[model samples]
Target chain A: MGGDLGPRATVEGTARALQSQSRLSACVFGPRALLAAEVDALPADLRVAAERLTLCDAPRVIDQAMKPSQALRAPRDSSLAMMLASIADGQADAGVSAGNTGALMALARRALGTVAGIPRPAISTAVPTRAGGRCYLLDLGANVEASADRLVDFALMGAVMARRVDGLVAPRVALLNIGVEGTKGSASVREADALLREFAGLDYRGFIEGDGIYSGQVDVVVCDGFVGNAVLKASEGLARMLMERVQATFEAHWSSRLVGLLARPALRRLKRELDPVRYNGASLLGLNGIVVKSHGGADAAGFGCAVGRAMQEVDQALPRHLARELDYWRRANASVACGRGVSGADPRRMDADNPQR
Target chain B: MGGDLGPRATVEGTARALQSQSRLSACVFGPRALLAAEVDALPADLRVAAERLTLCDAPRVIDQAMKPSQALRAPRDSSLAMMLASIADGQADAGVSAGNTGALMALARRALGTVAGIPRPAISTAVPTRAGGRCYLLDLGANVEASADRLVDFALMGAVMARRVDGLVAPRVALLNIGVEGTKGSASVREADALLREFAGLDYRGFIEGDGIYSGQVDVVVCDGFVGNAVLKASEGLARMLMERVQATFEAHWSSRLVGLLARPALRRLKRELDPVRYNGASLLGLNGIVVKSHGGADAAGFGCAVGRAMQEVDQALPRHLARELDYWRRANASVACGRGVSGADPRRMDADNPQR
Candidate 1:
C-alpha cells in the first residue's frame, strides 16, 4: 500500500510468506476492498486463516513533498497509520512496508516511538559483501547528521540486530571512516571510537576504511546516514552496471554468444547470489516495534521477502535484547555522558508507554 | 621511487614504455647506482639510454606519511623532486609517479601551479562502468571538504579531461548527491546545483545519485573527495569480494571446477576488462603541468600504463587548454563567479616566482 507497486506486490508477498513459513501470520494494511481482492487472488492452497490478515484502510501518502499536515493527516481510520497503531496496541508483532521511506519513518516514530536511550533511530541494511558473507550497514539514510552518542547507540543497536536477527555470534563491529587509523576521521568518529572502545559485552574491532565494507572483514559497519547512503547507492549502481555489461558482451559476437550459452548456468548462479530481492529488506532499528523497509520498487516476491525478514526479527526479540544491552552498557559506563546511569534511566525507555514493546 | 614498490617496478615499467612506443623519451630519476643496477638487470636491447637516466640522491624524509615538506625538501639532485622540477622547467613534458599521492599533488602544485581561476586541484580517475563504457569520478581523496566553487571547477576539469583523455566528445557531467531530484541532498549539493545551472558552457546533466555512478548514464561524476573516496573504496571492495566468491564457488566441487576451467577464458576476458591497471592513472587537474598519480600498490604493468597516460595528457596540452577554457568561461560570466571567476581571481595569472602556488 506504501510503495510505488502498492498492494498488488504486497498481497503477492503476503501469500509467499504464508507459503514459505506455516507459523507466520500477516496483518496487511490497506483499503479493505483492495486487501480482500489481493487475498482472494492468491492460490487456494496458500491462503491462510482469515483472522491472520488484518485490514486497515489507509489513504495513500506516497510523496514526502506534500504538506506533512495535509498529506499525512487522515481520518483516524487511515490504513498506514492504523497498521502502526496496531503494532503499538500489541495486536501486531512487527510492521512491514514498501512505501515512501520518509513517511514510514515518521509514522513509526510517532506511533511506535523510539527505543529507550536512543535519541534517533537508524535504518540498517544487510549488504552481500565481496567475501560472500553479509555485513550490516547502519544509519543507511535515517539521520543525516549524527552525534557521537547517537552513533554509539547505532553501533549497540546494530550489533544486537546482527547477532539476534542474522545469528552471528560475537559479531565484529567497526566504525566506517576515511582511513583505518584511529586519528584519521572527523571529530565524531574519534569520539565514537573512544566510547565504543569502553563499551562492554561486544566485540568492537576499531576503525574500518570504506574498502572494508565489501572486503567482508567485519560483520557490522556503523556510519552516519549520509556516508552510508552514498556507499549503498554506489554499490547498487556498480552491480547494475556490471550485469548490463556482461549481457552486452555475451551478445557482441556469435562466438561470444556460444560461450555465453556455456556460461549461462554459472552466470545465472552468480546473478542469483547477487540478487537485490534477497537482500531488499532494511530494518528501521531503535524503534519500539520492528519495522522493515522494503525497496520502493519491490515486486511481490521482494515484498514477500521483506515480510519474512520482519517476522524473523520479531520472533528473535531483537529490539528487547538490544534494549537490555543498552541498559547494561549504559549502567556499566555511568561516568560517560551517554551512559544510562548518568541519565538515571535509558533514553529509549521514554517510548515504552506507546504499547509497542 | 617513493611508493611501496619503487625503482624495481618503475625501471621495468619504463623499459616497457620505451618498447611500446618508439618515439617516447623518458628521463629516469632516482639514486644513480640503484637505477643503473635496475637497468642492467634488463636485456641489452631493452635497456634505456644512460644519459636519459639522471640520479638525484634525495634522502627519504618520511617513511610512508605523505607530507608536503618531504616532497619540497627532497634534494634537487633526487629523482622525485627533479622530475617535477624538470616538468616545470619545460625539460620534460609530463611527470608520472607510483609514489605518495599527497606528495605528488603537493609537488605538482608547488612547481606547475594551479590552472587559471581554479582554487584547488582534483584527482580524477576513470572507472569502468557497468554500461561497457568509462565514467570519470573526481576528487578521489584529494580535497575532503569542497566549496561550491571547487565543485564547479571539478565538473569543468573532469569534463575537459574526459574529452581530451578518454576521447569523450560533449561529455555529460553530473553532480553526485543523495538523490536524482534537484531539491534532494545536502546544502553543498544544493549550492553546486544552483552554480552549475547558471554555467552555460558545461553540459550539466543536473543531479545524479551515488547509484548512477556505475550506471554509465553520465560521462563525468563530480563530488567532494570524502564522498568520492568512500564510493571508490566500496566499489573496489565489492569487485574483489565478487571475484573471490566466484573462485570459491568453482572450488566447491569437482564438476564446478571443470565448469570453471571451461569458462576460464571468458572470466579472464572479464577480469582484463575490469582490471584497474588498464585505467591506473589519475590526473591532478588544475595543475600547470601534467601530473599523473598511480596506485600505491601498482606493479610494473600498472606503472607503465600510468606513464603512457601521462604522455597522452601532455601531448593533448590538457593544462593549457583547461587554463584557456577557464579564462574564457570566467570572462564570459564576469558578473557571476562562473568557474574561475568564483575563486575571486585568475589563478593562472599568479606570480611564477612564488614558492607555493
Candidate 2:
C-alpha cells in the first residue's frame, strides 16, 4: 500500500485480479479514506468482482527510507504488518505487497517464520528464456552475499519451486559463475558447486555462465543476492533500452512508421510476451505462509500479476511443500556428513593418494 | 589465428580492414604455407591492399583449453607470441589477436610488461549506450576477484583510457554495485568507493547499480572481472535472444512477412547499431604495448573492428599516458598518507568526538 504509486495501483490491481481469477478474494489494506476513494472508483463491469474485495483501514505508512529495524518496532497499524498478520493468523491463504522490500521481508519473517533450518526466506522469480520457457532465478535481493551453504539452501528452495510450480520432474540446477570451468567465480559460488555435486535428491548440473541463464538449459539458476540482483536489473535496463531504440527506429521515418502500423499487432504480442509487468511476482520462499512481493514500480497490470502469483502459491501450498523438502534435504545431508565413504572426498584416502588424481 | 573461427575470419578481416583504412598494414601469422595460401587467394579488389600485408610463420597454436601457464613456457613459434613480439621489438605499434584470451593476456604481459603501478593488464571495452555514446567497462575478465586496491587501479587505468582513447576530460567513473546506497554491495566495492573518494584528479561518482551502466551519464564503469564478465556475457546473450525473438515475431505470420519486407531497411539499420560484431575489440589496458582481443566467434567485419581499436590505441600512446597518470596518483596518495586533518577524517580528534557526529 505504501509503494511509490500507493494504493491506486495496488487496489486497482486487486480488482483486476478478482475479475480474472474468479475464486480469488482480496483484503486491501491502506488508510481508510484513501482506500475507500480508490475502491469506490471501480468501473461498472467490475462491480460483482468488487464484492470479493474488502478494504481494511490502517493509520501508518512504512516509507522506503525507514530501516527494517525502525519499521519493526511496535508496527501495529502498518499495512505490511497487518497483511502478514492476516496470513499468520490463518485468516488469509497468502499475501502480496508492493511496499518496502526490507520491511516486508522483516515483518513476514517475524510473523510467518521460516522452515526449521533456513535462517531467512529467499526471493525467487521466473525469467523468460530464449526457448519461450521460464528459468527460476533465486536470492534476487534476499541475501547480499550468501555463504556457500546459504547458496545451497537457495538452490533447494528454487528447485522445489520449479518442481511444484512448473511441474518439472527433476529440474536441472546450476550455479551462476563467471566461467563453466571448475576453478572460476568467487569462493562462495565455487564451494556451493562442490556441495551441490554431492548433495542428494537434486539434479545438479555443473557451473553456468550468466548467458546460460536464458539458454533454456537450466531449470534453476542460483547465485548470491548481489549478483542475482545485478543480472536481473541489468536485463531490465537492457530490455528497456532496446525497446526504446526499436521504437525510435520505427518513428525515425514515415515509411517505417507506416510499416510499423501494419506490424503493430505482432509487435504488441511480442511486447506482452517479454514485458516485466506480466511476470511481476517474486515469491518469498521459506516462509510458513506464502508472501509474494510485487516490484515497487509495477503498474496496475504488474501488481495484478503479483496477485496471480500469490493465488498460485496458495493453491500449491508452497510453504508446506518447501518444509517437507527441506526436512528431506537435512536428513540426507546429515547422513552424508556422518558416513566418510559416502562423499568419496574422504580425507583418509587423500592422505595416501594425489587429490587431483 | 588460434580463435574458434581460425584464420579464415582473421585473414579475411585483415584484408577488409586494410582496404578500408588505407594507411593500416598487417602481419598475418600462421604456418608459412597456410598463411601464403590464404593471402594468395585474396580477392582482386583487395590485391592492392594485400600488398601492404605481411605473412609471418608460426609453428604452434595455443588453444582454448590450454592453461595460461603452459602457454607461457617457450611460446617461441606460436602466432600469439609472434604478434606480441612484433610490438615488443618495436616492429609494430600495436597488436590484435583472435586467439585464446588467457594465452593472449599471459603472452602479451610477459612480452610488453605493464605500467609502473599496475601488476597485470585489465580487459577494457567500449559498450554502446542508450544515448548513442559509449561507456568504458573494465576488467572484463582479468583479475577475477579484484581487491579494493586493484579496483582503484582499474579505475585509474580506465580513466586514463577514456581520457586518451575517447578524448574526454575527467570521465565520470563509478563502481558497479548492487545498490546505489552506500551500505550495499560487497566489502571490496565499499572499500573501493572510499579509496576513489580520497584519490585526486578524477571525477568519482558514487556507486551505481547494474542498470545505470547504460544511462550514458557516467563515462566509465569499474567492477571486478567476475562481475564485469558476467554482466557482459549476459548482455550478449540477452541481446541475441531479443534479436532472435524479433525475427521470429516477424516470420510468424503471412501478413507480418510483407510488413517485415517493408520494415527491413530500418530493422537492418537497428541491427547494425546494436550488433556485437561492430564492437569487437576489448583493449588489454595497463600493458606497455597495445593489444586488442576480438570475439572468438566474430566474422570478418567484427575482426576488422578489433584491428581499428588497436590502431586508435597506437595513435593515443595509451601506455605512456597511463604511466604519467599513475605517477601523479602515487604521489597524491603518498601525500594523503603523510598529511593530517586534510581528509576531514582526522583520527587524532577521536577522543573528544563521536565518529558519526
Candidate 3:
C-alpha cells in the first residue's frame, strides 16, 4: 500500500498483531491479489483471519521525485489511497504505513483533514530514555518550520498522547530552547513559551535545556520540526555509535569477551529496552483519523508493532479526545480575547485584572 | 588572571602540568598576592619551579553591566590585560585562562590578533570516542553563525590539532549535517560541503550523520556554532542523565544493590572511561596563541585536567602549527584566484578553469 516493501511487511505485521492482541481486527488495504499472496505465505498458525483482512486494489507509487499529482494519483489506485478512503468513509478507524513520509503526510492532510484551529499536524515519536524509561517528543520531522501557534498545539497534542497512551497524568510539558530562561531562545521559542504559559489545560513546565529531552525531566517535549528533527536524528546517531563501540569492545580480546559473557544478560536487556522497532512508530497528530508512520527501514516485527499501535489509537478514540481538547483551547482563548477587548493579542497570559503579572 | 576561579584553578593546574611534564613552564597572571597564595597551597611535590611561576599583578574591572571600555581598558594593573601583554611582548609562549570566555576572546583578539586572512576564531572541543576514539568538533559555542569560508578554516585548524594532539596521521574530516549526502542539508551546509571538497590536504569524508559524532568514524566534525552548541549541550545532558539513572537503578532494591556490587568493576570501568573531567576542555582555534576553556562549572579536578590539556597544546606547539597551515591555505587560495582571473571567487574548487556557461 505504501512502497516497495509495503505489502509483505504489512501482511506479516497484520498477522502478528492479530495473534498478539485478541480484540484487534485489521482491514489491510492494497492490491487484493498481492495482499492475499502475502497473507497466504504466512505460516498456518500466523495466517490472518480472512474476514478481518479487507483488501483494496490500488496501484503503488515509488519514486521520490514524482510530481505530487502523479504520486497522489498513483497511490489512489493502490492500498494507501484506499485506506485513506476507508477512514474518510468511516469504514476504517485508522491507517498505518511504512511508505514515503512526505507522501503519507500529504495524503493524511488531504483526506483526514486537520483538527479545527490547529495550524499543522505534527508527528510525535517516543524515544528510549535511560533505565527502561521513555518520553514522547513531537514534530519529529513533520513540518520543517513551525509558527509559535503550531508549537503550542504540538504541546497540547503531545501532552494528551502521553497521558492517554503512555499513562502519564497531567504531563509536564517543556518548550525546548537554548537555555531555560524566558529570554534564552530565538524569537519563535520565546513567543511559543509565552503562548504555552497561557494555555489552560497544559501542565506547562517552562523551558527545558536540550539535555532535558532524555533526562525524564518532562513527559512531553515540544519544538519546531526543524530543531526536533535534527535533535532526534542526533540522538539516534549517538545510540547507534554507542552500540557499535560496545560491540567492537566486546569483540576486541579474550578477556573482554569473558567480560561480555558476564554482562550478556544486562546487555541483551538493555538492547531490547532501547530497540527502535519496539518504539519505531510515530503518530501524526491533529489529524481527523489515526495515522502512524512506521520507520521506513522497519522489518516485519517493527511493522507489526506499528499496526498494533494504530489499532490501539482507533480503539481508544484518541482523535475524539484530541478534538475535544482543541475545542477547549479555542473557547478559552476566545473568552480571554473578549475580556481583553483586543482582537489579535495572545490570550496565554495573566489577565490584567488578575494582579499576578 | 581571568575570572573568579581563574587564579586558584590556573595555579593548581599549572602545578599539575609542571609535575606531569618537566619540559613545561607557566606564567601565572593575576593579582600577585592571590597567585602567591594559590602557589603556596600546592603540594610540595606538585609545585612548579620558582623560575617557572612568574606572577603579573594586574587589577580587574568588575561590574554587573560592565561597559566595554570598563571591561577592555585594563587599568595597567589588570591581571587579564597583563597576561595578554605578556603573550604579546614575547614573555610567554601561550596564554591560558579560566575566566570569562567572552572577555578572554576579546582580549586575545585585541592583543595577539586573529590568524592572517581568517575572519573569526573558532572554539574546538576534543570529545572522547569509545576506546581508541577521539574526534574534534568545532565552534562549540563561540560563533553562532559561520560563513562557509570560516567553516573551512575550522576544518583545517581541527585537523591540525587532532593530528598533533590526538595522533591521527591524516585525520578524516566530515561536515556535520542532517544527512550523509551532498544534497541533504540547508543552504549553508551544501555551500560548505562544496567549499570543503576542494581542500586536498584533508582526508575529506563526505557528510557525517549525527550519530557519527561518537562513532570515531571521523577525526574532525565541522559546523557553525549554533548547532554545534546545541549538540554539545544535548550530549552532555544525555550522559549526565544516564549516570543518574545508573545510580538510581542500582539503589532501587536489595537485589539490584547486590547486582550493583557484582557489576561494580564494570560500572567503575565505564565511569572512568567516560569521565568528563578527563576530557572537559575546549581549545580556542585560529588565534595567535593557545587558549583552552574549561567548563564553567568545572570543579578542582576538572580544572586540573584543563590545565593538563593546555600543557599538551603547548607541547604540541598548536599555535605555530595552525599558523603555518593557515598561511599555506591563504597562499593556495590566492594562487587559485590568480589563475581563475576572478579576484574574489572561491579558490577551494578545482573547476576554476571551467567557467559557468
Each model's DockQ score: 0.55, 0.59, 0.31
Model 3, position B22: C-alpha lDDT score: 67
After superposition, candidate 2 runs with Cα above 4 Å error: A333-357, B333-357
Give the alpha carbon lDDT tens digit for every residue of A1-357 in model 1.
Answer: 767777888887877877777787777776678888877777676565444665666654345343334335645455667778888888888888887676677778888777665766799989987656899998888777678888888888888888888788888999987666664566788899998898777799999878899877899999888778888988887777766656565656677677667656766877888888998899999887888999887898899889888988878877777666666667777676544434466445532543335
Q: Comparing to the true complex, what docking class would candidate 1 get?
A: medium
Per-residue lDDT, model 3, residue B350, is: 20
User: What's the CA error at residue A13 for candidate 1, in Å?
Assistant: 1.1
Candidate with the greatest TM-score versus the true structure: 2
Give one digit per residue, the lDDT tens place, for model 1 in B1-357: 756687888877777877787778787777677877887886675654433444455444323464656657765555567778888887788888877666677777877788674666899888887666889999887787788878878988988888887788789999987666665667887898888888867789999888888887999999888778888888888877776655565556676677667656666777788788898888889888788888777888888899899988977888877776766666666655732434455545533322121
- Who wins the DockQ comparison? 2
Using lDDT, rank the candidates from best to worst.
2, 1, 3
lDDT of 3 by residue, A85-202 (tens): 7887777777888876766777777887775445568999987665356778888767655677677778889888887777777888998875575744567778888877877767
How close is every model to the real structure, measured as TM-score?
0.91, 0.91, 0.80
